[model samples]
Structures are given as C-alpha cells and as structure tokens.
Target: MSAQDRLVGAATLKRLRLARGWSLADLARAVSTKAKELGQPLDASVASVQRSVARWESSKGPILPGDRYQLLLAHVYARSAHGQLALSVGSDFSELLYALGHLGESERRLNDLRTLLVRTATDGGSGLLALLGPSTQRVLADALADPSKLDEELLEAMGIAIRDVNRQVGSLPFVRVQLMLTPIVESCRRLLDGTVPDAVLLHLRAVAAQAYTLAGRAAFETRDDEASRALYAAAAGGVGPPWRRAVVHMSHALVTLYSTPGIEAAQQLVDAAVRDARAGESVMVRARAHALQAEIAARAGSARHAKAALALAWYDIDSDCDGDPSPASFSAAHLRGFEGLTELYVGDPSKAHDYFAQSAEALHTPRERVQHAIVSTDQALARIRLNDPEAATELLHGCVDAASATGGRVAAIRLRRARAYLRPWRREDWFADFDDHLIESFGA
Candidate 1:
C-alpha cells in the first residue's frame, strides 16, 4: 500500500533472490513459465510482476510454501550453478559458496565463518555439508554473528535442511545434484595443487568418499545399480578408518546384488565385509556391515548365514554407543531401523515390530524415515505370512505410498513385489492395480 511498505518488500525479495543467486529477470521468467504450465494467464505487466514475484520472495509478504513440484524446480536451478562452480573450483569451496548463497542476513558473520572454514579445511571431513568449502566461514559468520550460535545444533540443523530439500522431491527430477560432485572433485584437485599437507589430503579424500556415497545413493534410488556400485566402490577406497571403508564396501555389495548380477561376486564382497567388520573398531560400522551381510545372505538363500550375520549385528548394536538403545554412528535412529530389518528378515516378527516402532518414532530425517517405512513393509509381509492378506495389503500400500513420497524407488519395488505375490488370492479388480504398480515400480 505505502511506498515504504513496497520498498521493504522489494528489498526483501531482492535479498532472497540474490541469496539464491537468481536475477530479477530469472525470477520473473520462472513465475511466468510456472503460471503458464498451471494454465493460468500471467498479466505480465510491471505491476503484476511487482505484486506477485516481489511478494513471493519478500519476507514481509506471505512466505509461500513450496510443494514437491516447485521444490524440485528450485533444486534444479540451485544445483545448476552449484555444479558448474564445483567443477571449476572444487567441492570444498563450492560447498561453502552454496551455504553462503542460502544463508539469510541474520545467519551471516565473519569470524565464525572463518572458524568454520578452518575447522572443515583442517578436520578430516565431518558433517555431510562441510564438504562444500572454506567460504562457509563467511557464510556461517554472516548467518550467526554470535560465535556461540555456531554449535553442533546449528550443524545438525543445516544437515537437516539440505536433506529435506534433497529427499522430499522424487529422485528423477533432481538427478542434477549428483552432477554437482564433478565440480567438487575438480575443485579438490585444484586445491591440492602441490605439496598439500597429509591431514588436508586425508580430509579431502574423506570428503570425496562422501561425495561418492551421496552420488551412489542417488543412483541406487534411480535403479542405475551399476553406477551406484561403482560410486560406492570409489567411496570405499577413499579415506577414514577400516570400519568406514568396510561400510562403504558393504554398501557396494548391496547395490551390486540389487542389480541382480553375479551372485557369487556379491557374496564374496559380503564375505569380505564380514571379515573387515570382525577386524574393525567402530561398533556402529561393524553393526552396519553385519546387517548388510545378513540382508545379502537372506537374498542368496543362506538362511544359516543370514541368521549368523543378524546375531552379529544385534550383538554390536547392544554393545556399542552411549545412549540408551544406542544410536548408530550413521544416525541414532537408523541403526535401530536396520536392526528391525535384520530381525524381520531372520523370522522374528515381534522383535522386528518393536524395533521398527522405535525407529519410526525416533526418525526425523527424511531418508531415515524411508528406512522406517521399509521396515513397516517387512512387517506387512509378516502379516501376509500369517494369512491376513487384507491387513497386509493395507500396510503394504501405506509403506509404498510413503516410499514414493520420499522418492525411494528401491523400497517401492520391494513393496510392489509383495503386492504381486498377493494378487492370486485377491479379487480381479485388485489384479489391475497390482499389475500397474508392479510395472511402474520396476519400470518393466
């Protein structure tokens, strides 16, 4: 209404758009295109643009919530520049720039930003997002002027934000995020030009491993199993301790088996993971390796081996970590869910249900929650085994929908397989739905 109000709104919009590294023209084009796609005619006048685009970006105006569709578009735009920069500079610097680009004015500070840069640049790669860059120092400093505010809580908050953005949208549309790693790897190469410290190199290697792991997970979700296996293998060879290496190798083995190729090779890799776990120090990592081995053993029809792997995982779970029920090193809640999955696969429904419930309750992260949903699906299968097809179908449907919500294709496929198995006993109408879901889930 007032000029002052309009100016404030415009300034806020300008600030947010800049933070996202988008220009006014870019924002206007996006708005117009989105409106057209929605079958709404854009007025396309200066006044209309000011009222809509400005208000959308403005803090004073209503902060429009992004649905999955809009968020997917935003991620596309964000990662385009991010990927290019990563290739040019390296991940360490690119990641910092990303943090800076996203930070609100209140979140920025100088010295704190410097400290973060120094810590990440020095430490052997800690947080998931820390792989971005040293410029995070400036970004974090600007975001939190008071040094005290940049604690573990803040780091977790940042990790959660990144995960939310990456996971909420389906994986198909957001595949570009994986490409961003190329620039990151390139940047690391430039940063290590010559005579780099051993610690820094180690940290860089650790960061690269994480980059590969992230890319591998993305590939796995997209059913590019070979790509996933290759990325996980690279990650396994990167850095950190033997336990971390073993975990990565175990992940590689899982992806390879999922690809349905060479069962003997997959089994050999699993066996190696088991041997590594036995020799490793980290209880959490050992537990994960064993859990994965258990899943592989089950799939390979080695019921005895599966049970033994499950027992090893449970033992490690009970012994490791400080918290009650103990958190997995990966995430406190994820470990619990994996344990539940192991239980279900080993034919212990009651125990599986208890662990699944715990994981479901404790999960806050999107990925971890998807894992919980898979456990729930396994519970549904257990119900089906007991002849309650109706109850089992309901649970399966719920889990499948939840997995789809998070873009978890692997979990969706498993649910579809279960549904297909139930098709014979169900009514004819259900057959069509089951068939459609199976095709969609498997892309067959």
Candidate 2:
C-alpha cells in the first residue's frame, strides 16, 4: 500500500474507533475472533491491535480483512456503551487509538493529545480516582509538596509538566497548577532513599537546575537581585558538564548585567558564559547564553557587538533541538521586546515598534507580559526624542496603566522617568502625580 493510502485508511479507522467506546484489547479480541470465523486469523493483543489499527487508518494501505474488522468493531462498540464507564473507558480507548494513528505524521500533535488525556484523567472521574488509590494519591501529593524531598524521576516529570502547563496557560501565575505541583515534587525528592542511581542523580540535578533558573527569573523581576543571583548560582551548581555549568554562568551574567556593577566586569562574565555555552551539549542552553551575551553587549554601548550577539541569539532561537525544539525559543515574546528596546536604543523606533508588537504577542506569562508596558514606555521615550511630547504623554499613560495592571513596578518607574523627561513640554502640574507615584513605588 502507498503511504498516502495508508494514512487515509488509518485516519478513517481512527475516527471510527474513537467514535466507539472500546479499548484496543476489546477491539482486537472481537476483530481476531471475527477474522478467525472468516478463515483469516489475526492476532488480537495490544501490539497486534496497534499494528492492525495502524494499517486500517493508513491513508495509503490496501484495505484488507483486518481493516474491515477494525471498522466493524468501531461500529459495534460505539452503540454498546453508556454512562461514566462509557465515557471514561470509551474516551480513553478512542483517544489512544486516534493518537496512535497520528503518531507517524506529527509527533507534536500526538504529544498534545497525550497531554490532554493525562490532564483529563487527572482532573476527572471516580474511576480515575479509584485507579490511583487514595494512598498513592496521598503519597504523590505529599511528595510534590516539598521540593527538597523529591526524587530524580519525579523532579524531571514535574519540570516537563511545569513547562507544558506554562505553555498552555500563557502565564506562570503564582497560584497556578505548576506552583501547586512544586512542593509535591520537592517532597518526593526529599523522601528518596540513597538507592538512586547516578544517572538518576544527573537528571534530578537538571530538573533542580531548571527550577532554580526559573525562580531566579521571578526574583529578578521583583527587584530581589540578591535572591535572584543566589538562585541562578544554585542552578549553576548542578551536576553536568558544559551544559549545566554554562547555564549557571549565563544566569550569573544576567544578574550582573542588571546590577550594572561595571561594564568590564559584566562583559567578562558574559564572555565566559558564551564560551561555556558554546562547549555545552544542549542547544537551549547555548541559545540562552548567546541571548545574555547580546544583552550585555547592548548594555556596553557596542551596538555592533550587541547586534552580532543578538543575531547569534536569533539563530539559536531558530535552530531545532534534537527533533524537539525548546518551547522557550518558540514562546520567546520577551526576546522581541528586548530586540525592540535594542532598536530603540540604536535610533530606529519603527523597527523597535515592530519587534515590540511581535514580542507582546508572544509573551506568555503575566509577569513578563507586562514587558509590553515597558515597550510602550520606550516608545514614549522615542516620541520625546522626536519632540512629540503630546504623543509621548498618551503613550506613557498607557504604559503606566499596563504596568499597574500587571504589577510591573519596574516598568512603571521607567514610564515615570520618561514622563519626567518630557515634563518641560507639559504643564507643571503633570509632573507631581507621576513624580510622586515613581517615588512611592520605586523609592529614591
């Protein structure tokens, strides 16, 4: 059978199977028995069913007895089940088969389907509740409640889940499911016996490292530079060669860039991070290191170096990762925001606005989404540069409003500064309100 024919058949079989409420085993059993009676026997195990189902759903396959049996089973099963069992068992079976049908075509779509199934099962049903005994549920819940106690496997799973959930929701709000899952994961780690293998320890360290990196980002946003630095440093301390160490150093570079201790010191740190990241294994880590280098260069008044670094960062963002690119690359609205700011600094507000708009669209988290407000403030600054104080006032007001809504005090302060810079073109009274607000929110 041609590939196209197999895909067509597979898709049809998948729809029919899902429309029915039967498991692979159930369908295999019925189909196998029917085939036997018809003088053609086929295996009915999960693997056999999987294969037969694959053939039937294949768009390019020659439709055989096995395919016919699969279609028949789907027809019979859909009309047979009812109630919670019907919904639970039927949906699970159908979803699984449907998912399998798409496996060869789009792995990402299959992954999405699987995630949906797991999340649905997690959130639904007394049947699911019974499947996971109360004791097991309690254990998992307790384990995830404390990060310091989580084992390696659980930590890695949690890390993946956190990223997945963040992608789905577009924001890592403090009260989100990821936050709820963190403690349970930590608890599991803490409860781990010394029997864990070295391989497991490596994986655990990676998960912990990622968690610390995220935590540091949160801290940095809140103006807790000390805490942010500590978390980033902790992430760096995790075990692994170039990848892990490079990430840690990059985190340090980020903190240093923001702290602005000195251009020379910051550039040195950035250079080291870039070197380590280049030697690292993960493309994601390398990309981040490059991004940080770009930021540092941008801050150092070397527009040429900044542009080069940013270009490298963009390349990393575009590169595919081991068949599965990092979501950070795809979901990086903040990069555009940064790019917009970079363009603005380099005297190209038009390009800056375009990048800023793109970044705003890509931003996923509330904390970072407020970065759009910062962009607006920067736009206002640009307008001021152009001697368009009236337009700048309007933009700054929007910036303030956006920042206030998202709890972006830092952005708000910047907006206020922009307003202050434009005060000479405004009534004297306009200065007091923004001035007082900045002082109150950001202090001296």
TM-scores, all models, native as reference: 0.57, 0.57
Residue-wise lDDT of candidate 1 within 260-316, one digit each (tens)?
666777778777777776776777777777777777766666678877877877787
- Identify the leading candidate in terms of lDDT: 2
Give one digit per residue, the lDDT tens place, for model 2 in 341-427.
667776477777677667656553443555567766776776676666676666666566566544454575677578668668555
lDDT of the candidates, in the order given: 0.54, 0.55
Model 2 accuracy (lDDT, Cα) = 0.55
Worst 10 residues of 2 by lDDT: 83-92
Off by over 4 Å in 2: 1-137, 140-153, 164-195, 239-252, 259-269, 281-288, 314-327, 330-336, 346-368, 426-444
Model 1: lDDT of residue 306: 77
